[model samples]
Target: MDALTALHNRVSTGKLTEPAPTEQQRKNIFLAALRAADHACLRPWRFLLVEGEGRERLGGIFLKAAEQAEGAALTEAQRQRTKAMPLRAPLIIVAITRLQEHPKVPHLEQHMSTAGAVQAMLTAAYAEGIGAYWRTGPLAGNPLVAEGLGLANNERIAGFIYCGTPDKAPRQAPDLAVDEFFSYWGAH
Candidate 1:
């Protein structure tokens, strides 16, 4: 698919199955992310690819974090759900933002750069016929999760991108009116 087409039509695929993206597809996706706009060239981002057994390990970490946060209040179903979260997709990419004290660029801009990279990867994945979903919840911000993922004190989780083969056809992108979101800012 063309770049513009992918950018306009990309949609998150929540139901993913086995057969993760091929090596070529992953190369394309990562390359797209590398081209994201960066302020002051402060490349403050890193990614961890987890698949197969690694997903199971991530699920364990998630379960631990959830259990810690909820204590005895969490039911068995909730615990099971937390442990199975990583099994939703065949491959997972954990996006991390490494904040630094830059004279010009602040931490927020660094995060924005990471967000741009993730969006680019999503579009590239769509073009490559790979299912992708960006997910983040309370667990993403949990200190236990951060520590389990071996994140540095200056690094934070941006999101977890699940990628694999779509269990079904991707849903159509919503038709949003540009006029409703954009307007010319000129002398009126």
Candidate 2:
């Protein structure tokens, strides 16, 4: 599909099924991510894929975060719920950003670059008939999650991209008027 059509049709696929993408397919996805718009070629993005039994380890990270956040107040049931998040999908891709020392490349720029990479990955998945969803829910920003992903103090987990075969065809997306959001010069 063309870029505009692919973008206009891309929708988050939260409900997925068994059989995650193969290693070769994942490589293709990563290649697409590398082509994302990054000013000065900083390449500040990194990704970690969790699949199969590896997903269990990721769930442990979420559980740990809940434990740390709630301390002794957290109930066992809540802990178990946290542990179930990664199991909801066939695969989870952790997006990370590393800070660079460029004088002109601020931290925000690096973050934008990472986000670009994430969108590129999602678009590539859409193009290849795979379902992908980027989530920055509570677990994604948990400090224990960063530790679990082995991120540096200066690095952070931007989000998790859950990917798998779609359980069903994508639903129609809602449309919004752009002019409602746009501002006119000297209108105020």
Residue-by-residue lDDT tens digits, candidate 1, 1-188: 99889989999999999899999999999999988889888888999999999999999999999988988578989989999999999999999999999999999999999999999999999999999999999988999999999999999999999999999999999999999999989887
lDDT of 1 at 169: 95
The count of backbone overlaps in candidate 1 is 0
For each candidate, how many residue pairs have backbone atoms clashing (under 3 Å)? Answer: 0, 0
Which residue ranges in model 1 land beyond 4 Å of their true spot? none
lDDT of 1 at 122: 96
Q: Write the per-residue lDDT of candidate 2 for residues 53-105, one digit (tens) a residue.
A: 88898888788888888785777787788888888789889999998889888
TM-scores for the candidates: 0.98, 0.91
Runs in model 2 deviating more than 4 A are 183-188
User: Candidate 1 lDDT (Cα, whole model)?
Assistant: 0.94
As for model 1, its CA RMSD to the true structure in angstroms is 0.9
Residue 136, model 2: lDDT of 92
